[model samples]
Target chain A: MSRSRIAFVTGADRGLGLGITKRLLELGWDVFAGSYLADWPELTELSQKEPERLHVIPLDVASDESVQAASRAVEATSGRVDVLINNAGIATHYPRTIHEEQVEEELLQIYNVNAVGPMRMAQSFVPLLRAGAGKRMCFVSSEAGSINRSFRDNWYGYCMSKTALNRGVQCLFDELRPEGFTFRLYHPGWVRSYMSGELNTDGDLNADDAARMAVAYFLRNRYEDQGMQEEDRLVMRDWLGREWPW
Target chain B: MDQIVLITEAHHPWGRALVREFAQKGWRVMACSPVSVEMFQDAFDTDRIHIFTMDMRSRESVQQAVERIQEQTSRVDLLVCGTLSSQGKESAGIANMSADLVLEDYQANALGPIRVIEACLPLMDHGLRRIALLSDVQGSLGLGLSGAGTGYAMSKAALHMAYTMLHGDLGRKGFTFRLFEPGPEPETEVSAEAAAAYFTGSREDEERMVMLDWRGQEVPL
Candidate 1:
């Protein structure tokens, strides 16, 4: 097996996931970019530029079979993975209330992709993570999930799904942190990316800058999350390194 | 004419207690259960406490239940959502959790209450327009330290956000809300009586909705 660091990122076709994969590649780590959008050209082009260092594979975190296959593919190609970033997520533009619209359909669709997707990734990638030197699990969460700091009054599923993701990460931390698996529960701080089915230009930051902060946090303390004194406790930190209430 | 209150998941202890407490206070109670509600009909005054067969998981069932409620009463004064899905083995770690089990909890705990809430909104206007929700401390992102009850915690957190959004919209429309995290302790089962009292009492913060634990401590969102 190669001594070089290995990182696997889901939703790496474009936006923050792609940006993170690019940053990891630039930092000299061999990155397995899990591409859901097989047709999206940026990751493919990046892989072509750095063929030996970047391996792009088809992955869908929402499906059990797809996640399982992606994990096996990564394990076969890379032998082990140092970091697993579960960043694949989806959101809706509908701001309608339950009185105005039937919310069950949207809730199910978003929850399956945004909340359950990462748990599937974690389950599939844990074996490879255990074999590697750096056992770090990073998540691309949002301030929308922060119930304490919540401001939006209309859309439900995205925020609810993110909140679920935050709690899910906390639960994972409770179990895995004891096994020397450190976690990064990150809020990327509203970067302009492809969350609304297109590259959004409204947000203050861009994908590359958000990915820069995310990669730095993901690799901190060599393996362990910085300032975490106890193994069982976990905190959600933003791009600015400010601790957020879980 | 008495004030009318609608409570879901009357099968659960918390739901049953709320029904009893509300009925004893001379308010008309609509106790909704998926199972047979024969016991409630005899226990409380049949005129005050009525039973409806409702399954929150099914939108059809919820719509039918709300229609039945509308035919009997002109308006519903209070809506107390007691439906929850947290139970044994649903607390399994992330790796071991069954996706079906997790989604089942989401159906019950997260989306179920809203299914009923939205249907009952039309009847709430010109009434008390008060909404009450039962929450778990496990749902609090700021308080979650337990091992993964992925579905339960996620669903509860989802429900809490829904509550927040509901408050934001309806609070401006002369509606009041009470979110109570009931417990004998945070580690054990919910305390129905304390929750009943908390729900029946006055608000501490009039400007915005807040979740209060059994000890009346303000729980962070």
Candidate 2:
């Protein structure tokens, strides 16, 4: 049997990130779960469940020092990292607009965390990724970033931050394409995470369903042949594996 | 007949497929990229596809492409812009990344598309036309975690705002704007070897690449 892969997921304390971490552990992989808040109860329980397989660490993707510290901790313990999931994220308030009346300093906060955080994670952990068996980096992006399908007008700050993240992932893909790493910018659709006020759902999936689907996608490993083709980037597949146009 | 003009940024492996798909659908397809014809021969038919050699980062290149389109067609029915670039894993961190890298992201991801829109607006046939800009979930202000790609993220966020404002400002003129978010792709079929190559020297990164696919859900954009 293939050796169990090592995975590192940011924002694994709760929501989609937590679900993903749980699923990875269940699959027999060694997981380095990063959480901004070190004392998260869910993480405590997870570590207890699989003391050897799970390593919970403090990680703030937005902070350089924090990211470096987390990387050092991982390197000391694991020696190699097979997968890096940039899933640690936050969603401030809702119904945002670009006009001055609706804008605030909170907008910058959003950008710092959403836009810069993942890049920091990649930079800090890429060396470990290079030493792993599977050189893959996955960014938990959303279709909200797609320029081709935007029709609404209220989500100014949120929309803007996500758009930047998408662009960053594309750049990363290009930068890493020559180096031989499989980089993916993914939109986990709308799942019922804490940031979504537990209201985001696409009818068929909850957090667990979304996590399962994401893991399934990761296991398939078809990025090399397909690359980031337009159709692939914006594909909307149902729970039944049916594809939908963006 | 419903007149449609689909514009795609010609880079990456997907550009060719985009050109082919739109052309087959009978839409007037316009593909622009810095690469030579020989580079994308498989994806575009020189005779059937309207090809423009332009750098999205340059205003002149954008203007030239717009002029060529104007000469051939009086108005554009639909507009779609897809452009991408990268800085590689060696330059992943803030210390390793440069200001130019960030600017390049904005020029290519944000300004380029806006410039294209500015040029194409004159050709938009009033209320009948629709425009869509590609964006991602990563730019979510509420869900952000860290500083990943300063330039890329800032540009995308700017573009999203641009699109949102455009939707409102243009609504009076009968133009429709929409943001489409594409969920993550399954990782099983993606090549590990190719992914390894992209990592280059990071052959030992043990992190498993798992993508969370949204289960056919609509995001609240």
Query: Who wins the lDDT comparison?
Result: 1
* Predicted candidate 1 versus true structure: per-residue lDDT over A77-167, tens digit per residue: 8778999998988887766675675667778878888888888888888889999988889898888887777777667888888888888
True-structure lDDT of candidate 1: 0.82
Q: How far out, in Å, is residue A183 in model 1?
A: 1.4
How many collisions per candidate? Answer: 1, 105
B40: Cα error in model 2, Å: 47
TM-score of 1: 0.91
Per-candidate TM-scores read 0.91, 0.56
DockQ of 2: 0.13
> TM-score of the second chain in each model?
0.90, 0.74
* A28: Cα error in model 1, Å: 0.8
TM-score of chain B taken alone, candidate 1: 0.90
Q: Largest DockQ belongs to which candidate?
A: 1
> Fnat of each prediction?
0.69, 0.30
User: Which DockQ-derived CAPRI band holds candidate 2?
Assistant: incorrect
lDDT per residue for candidate 2 within A1-246, as digits (tens), equals 134799999988887888899899888888989987665598889799888889988888777788889999988887778899888766765664422233334555555567677877877888888899888888776555554455556655566666667656555665665566776556676677776444454434587778887776665565435445332332333334544322
